[model samples]
Target: MLGIDCPKPKGRWPTAPFDPRFPKQNQTRNCYQNLLDYRPCVKRMRRRGKSTQPCEYYFRVFHALCPMSWVQRWTEIKDGTFAGKI
Candidate 1:
């Protein structure tokens, strides 16, 4: 997955999530590829005030870079957690 710069969809978030069973259709989604990409996006989005970006990207996969669980764990915290309070 290195050297890949996929394009993210623009405009309002999609009303539904891309089906994971058929990932190629959602392969363009370049989100949650790594902890580096996932944690920081979540961190900045959480810090952003009065915005829908967080909710949108939290569960939204971009170019299939990140996993759904990684995005869904936005609110997950505490010891031994994946990535939190960063």
Candidate 2:
């Protein structure tokens, strides 16, 4: 038998963690909040001349929950059009 080393799997699938604020089964608001939070985090970090790495958490959460089309459309609009305070 040919000997080969297989790499062990790393972490679990990229999904949002349970947020105490949104304990209910519905995650619609959770997804929306993440999207809103992500933008402001990026803006704030950039304004402070800091890395945007921390904002990735919000980005990951929203992407996991929100539909692609909605994310795309929301992102495409300028800041003025976005209802959220980004």
Candidate maximizing TM-score: 2
For candidate 2, write residues 1-86 as lDDT tens digits: 00111123256646788999899999999999998888778778878999877887787788788887987777677646777765
In candidate 2, the residue pairs with backbone N, CA or C atoms under 3 Å apart (3 or more residues apart, or in different chains) clash, namely: none
Q: Report how far residue 53 has shifted in candidate 2, in Å.
A: 0.3
Per the 3 Å backbone cut-off, how many clashing residue pairs does candidate 1 have?
Answer: 10
Question: What TM-score does prediction 1 earn?
Answer: 0.28
Best by lDDT: 2
Q: Residue 48 CA error for candidate 2 (Å)?
A: 1.0
| Residue-wise C-alpha lDDT for candidate 1, range 1-86, written one tens digit per residue | 21212235676655435556446755433353433454456546556754435444443444234555743453354434544233
TM-score of each: 0.28, 0.80
Which residue ranges in model 1 land beyond 4 Å of their true spot?
A: 1-36, 62-80, 83-86
- Candidate 2 versus truth, CA RMSD in Å, comes to 11.4
